[model samples]
Target: MKSPENLLKSFFAERIKGLVQSDIRRMSRECERLGGINLGQGICDQPVPDSVKEAAKSAIDRDRSIYSKFEGIDPLRERIAAKMADYNGIRCDPDREVVVTVGSTGGFVAACLAFVEPGDEVILFSPFYGYHRNILSLCEATLRFVTLHPPNWSFDPADLERSFTEKTAAVIINTPSNPCGKVFSRQELILIASLCQKHGALAITDEIYEYILYGEHRHVSIGSLPGMEERTITLSGFSKTYNMTGWRLGYAVGAAPLMEKIGLLNDLLYICAPTPLQHAVMAAFDLPPSYYDQLCADYARKLEMTCAACDEAGIRPLLPQGAYYLLADISGLGLSDDKEAANFLLGRAGVASVPGTSFYADPEDGRQQVRLCFAKQDGDLEEACRRLRGIRTARP
Candidate 1:
């Protein structure tokens, strides 16, 4: 008899299997096994917000146990709409233009399938989030990479513009970006928006990190541009904003027709977001502005603390204007390969980090970089820093 694994489809989607199982998770698992402090996954090293926990409790108590309309209920949708209008400054009709999904991850995957036909090319700017590659693969779309050259993870506009083609179906922007913590400037966004509009393509903006920005930088949505809202799908979640990753609540906002189609797609894939979790999101949107102010303040403190350590290590980092992550160069330590350095730190120094090499399709693009999430308590950041400082390559 043939092996069970051999029974799977041949000529199967090559892209699906090509993805590395989020390197961050693998490192987190190793650290857990060894009882080391984990900073690999972007999950909060803090407590779940009391309001969200209470909302979840309230939902369960109210017997919110049945399936909901596949597009989500009116109250939660209205709350989401209001949140967008108030914060993102884009007014949307909740009933016509919104569909709640499992998380921003789901929203992105569904949007990718909704917008991309097989063989369509999508432009990705790296170090991009890890899951974008997975979504592109599952959508069966071809990827064109645009790299961000460091110490400042900024791209040359001419290089990025050259990557756009008539075959280009969509362009994605994530800011404050995932690994680099660089928030794109307004002029940069306008340039991208103009190109997409000129070419009749779509822009998908992942704003899941909206509230997590620090310093003088603010998170701006490409959909917020003069003529982009109709063609853009804004993806965001309660996961990062509320320390509610496990809550699995997120939303997609776009034009009514596009959203209607995505709603149908969601019906096929998930039926609707978890009914109880959707109910909980209503309370999330109503959080006072003070709550957000404090959240930003807390993250700013963490950013400075961690990057200061990187500075002390004799590596000057591109100070993050937003987002919770800071990517540091490993070359100063005489390390030539990030994967080798990451393994050494995890095994020898009792620290774990995502190698920047895993964030790019071609390892050569980011071989000398490492991504560290500063979304930790002070004690955790301090301990990790101390461990990282102890690296003495002369022994090796």
Candidate 2:
């Protein structure tokens, strides 16, 4: 008779056979065990706005616990539509084109399920967010990668153009990218849009960090490009902008025809996002423009502090154009690879970071790097910075 482990392994589906928790979660677990500060996961340990919290409380008091329409509450959809037009420059009809989801992640899954099939080819940028890669894999889509070179994290246009083929069904774009905070420029989006149009491929974008920009970098939704309105599915959420990651509220916007299938998948999978939280996130849109300004300013300061600490510790910080993550080169640490460097940092400095291997397709590409999250509270981030700086002296 086979052992219990072998029996369970044989019963599991092929798609999920080799899947495990990501290195980000693994590092966070180890950090927790050691009582170390975790910069591994992008948890955004900041205070949620009081108005949003109060609105949730008010909704609960009023008994807003029933399942909502699978697409979401009308008021929230209307707000999302208004914001999409004003901020993202993509005009959409809330009633037909919007589908509120469990998170932007849910939107991505729905998009993948609705559009991708076995033997279809998808183009992805390397140093990608792990969820995007894994979800596409789970759907059995063949991925062709385009590398995003470091420093600015820009891709070669020739490489991107060559990635398209007759089998290309969709391309996944993550602007203000995680791990490496690269915001795709408008010119780049225009180029991508032209290719998608040429190849008859759809564009699926994740723009969850739309508001967390730095320097002169701006967020551009490819869906807003002249020819992309019908071909692009835009995904974003209140989680990053309002410091409400646990709320699990996000939405997708696209042409009505595409959204119909995505909405059905959402209905089949989740029924609806949490009812009361949907009501509460409506308050988030009411925040003034200055609120966004301050959010950027606060994150800019955090970025500066964290980058300085990494420099002091001899890890060369790759300055981000936007988003809250910083990827640093750990080659100077005299370790064999990113995993060893990460473990050394966690053990020596009591600060946890994700091994860079988590974000790349090839292990060698990330062998000398690690990613750090700076979206932390002021006191906690300061402590983390101090601990990181101590690594300079702690090294043998």
How many pairs of residues collide in each model? 0, 0
RMSD of 2: 0.7
Q: Evaluated with lDDT, which candidate comes out highest?
A: 2
Superposed by TM-score, candidate 1 places the C-alpha of residue 247 at a distance from the truth, in angstroms, of 1.1
lDDT string, candidate 2, 45-148, tens digits: 79999999999999999999999999999999999999999999999999999999999999999999999989799999989999999999999999999999
lDDT of 2 at 393: 87
Q: Per-residue lDDT tens digits of candidate 1, residues 175-219?
A: 878878778888889999998998888998888888877657777
Cα lDDT, all candidates: 0.82, 0.94
Clashing pairs in 2: none
lDDT, residue 375, model 1? 84
Model 2 vs. true fold: TM: 0.99
